[model samples]
Target: MSLRDRLKETRAKASDGFRGGKLMSSIFRPGSPFRKGYVDSPRNRSYVVMNNVLYHLHPVKVKRHGVRLSYTLCLGGLSFFLFIVLTITGIWLMFYFRPTELAYVDIQNLQTTIAFGSLVRNMHRWGAHLMVLVVFLHMSRVFYHGAYKAPREFNWVIGVILLLLTLLLSFTGYLLPWDQLAIWAVTVGGNMAGYVPVVGAQVKFGLFAGLEATTATLLRFYVLHVLFFPFIIVIFMAVHFWRVRKDGGISGPL
Candidate 1:
């Protein structure tokens, strides 16, 4: 057997007979990162990174270039942070919102009556816009950095799916106010969807819930904005992060 394999066997035998036997071996497993500076060697370093709970999201022993501040310009991290902010602010806005025709009145009350309501609403609105930009920029950074090559190709597709979901979220929320502006904007958007070849009519109908936008459309968009889209985006985000770690962490600098 290889030296490393033999070493593993010896460690197992030793652990099987130690004071706490298997319990100690389980917690302190060979090369447990909790034992800091344990032997400073390649094998130990790899084991440390592999066994550390905190490394689940990002393996610390990454390439030298991946550590540079300018390498990614923090776009990916910022995009994720903005998503979290949007989620928090979105939830806060939800408590005061209604998807019916009274939605506009509810919005006005939020802005004029509820304490910090205007602030939170504005934060949610602007945060959504910023998240769209940030996610796009993050994708652009990945593309230019060649991080989308090879095994990361699937992640690139996931990122694109996320960006599209972000756009849909933003569009759906735009109608939550139930104002004339929202109506006109969505009408124009739906009309555009109606030109999409074979599924055009169905797409537009599905979007606005009838021949045109209505109270039903408002409720439909509301559910999609507040529930469906968010749930779908989150699932994609999890897989994207998992692929990042599995594909040997982030790619090195170009």
Candidate 2:
């Protein structure tokens, strides 16, 4: 057997012999020194993973210098980091902004009133665009790497759903400014939804909450942008992260 396999066997045997409450304590305690630096420690094992069945998801020993640049650059982590940046900047902008009839003028005043508000807004806007582009590229990388095979297929589907949700989030947020571009963009988007054959009109009405782009439409988009999609995206992201572990730690090229 390999040295690492033998070592894991020895550790398992040793851990299995611990008696009393001490056994369970050591098994469950993440900070237990006995478990630290050991590969088979319960805290370090894949037992907690809920998706798929692949257990060799983590390296027994990861080399610090072996990580590939393409994986780091094109993986979804960069997109996530950009999303975080946008979230922080969006929150900051919210302090001096409102999402109503004067939203556009308020945005204009923010550019002039709040210190660095214009920079913050620009960062938020550009970061959002970059995030969308990065997410699409990340999915492409995953696909090209054959990372979505077997146990990872479900996670791949989830990733696709997350991508769609991310696009929806960006679209909804576009309307909160109440600008001409925002209005027409949403109007065109709603009209597209309205072209859903027999249910097109109903779909459009549901999205706008009326026959026209009234206060209800703005309020609906505002709530969706600020609340609903964020919560759903965060949940799916959590699932995605967990699935990464379950799918054998981001599949390598065949």
Candidate 3:
């Protein structure tokens, strides 16, 4: 065949292959693993939500009043967002931190010498405080709106547990810096734990692992901060969200 005729045949084959692929893709529904389609219709949108791991957390149908910004205020969502921010920044900060006497020096170097280290540390610190505040406010909002009534009562209890977990996460992270401020603050907090009736002293002893904040205390707090408490918090948070769906989505007017 002539070179021009050969080139023409090759182009035709390529075009045919492309058309065949397109036709195969068109056969599957939108959001199929093979091809994602535009969500132009209600059914397609529902399919998208149902198919997505994250969006499936939401109910297929929502009440008109349940979505009002003024009523819900999105506090619960913002609290969860801040927790995610803390988790990211905390993981980054963990790379440079040590649970020993060098921890303070490492933090100082992280803030002054490392690139964007200070930003990440500050974000984790502030995000921890903000998560506590937002979770508390979310609980208050739920209580004031009487959203805790009926089937949601257990979810409300779950929310309270989450709030406590938020506080514990912050408290455990507080000792990681190993500075004078962290030491004294944790000392005071531990003393409060000592005020409990029977297990008070035992709790304090377990917290410090000694009479004072030593290497043992630091390591214990580090393990809890990095591993134990976060795992628990995530598990409970998942349960809390699932219960929100089971209890009929976000609370609304009666």
Q: Which candidate number would show the highest lDDT if scored against the true structure?
A: 1
lDDT for 34 (candidate 1): 39
The list of candidate 2 runs beyond 4 A from truth reads 1-66, 72-74
Please tell me which predicted candidate would have the highest TM-score against the true structure: 3
Mind giving the per-residue lDDT tens digits that candidate 3 earns over 1-254? 99999999999787656544677466644554434334467777677677766678787678898788888899988988898888888889989998898998999999999999988988889888888889989998999999999899998888889988888889988988888888889999989999999999899999999877787888999999989999999999999999998888877785
Candidate order by decreasing lDDT: 1, 3, 2
lDDT of 2 by residue, 20-113 (tens): 2465555544433344233555555433332213322344443343266756564587887887898899888878767677788888988898
Evaluate model 2: give its lDDT: 0.77
Candidate 3 residue runs with Cα over 4 Å from true position: 1-29, 32-39
- Better candidate by lDDT, 1 or 3: 1
Q: What tens digits encode model 1's per-residue C-alpha lDDT throughout 1-254?
A: 89999999998766546634566566775676434235778898777767766554667577888778888888888888888898898889889988998899999999999999999999988988898898898988888888899988998999999999999999998888999999999999889999999999999999989999999999999999999999999999999889998888879656
Colliding pairs, model 1: none
| Regions of model 1 farther than 4 Å from truth | 1-55
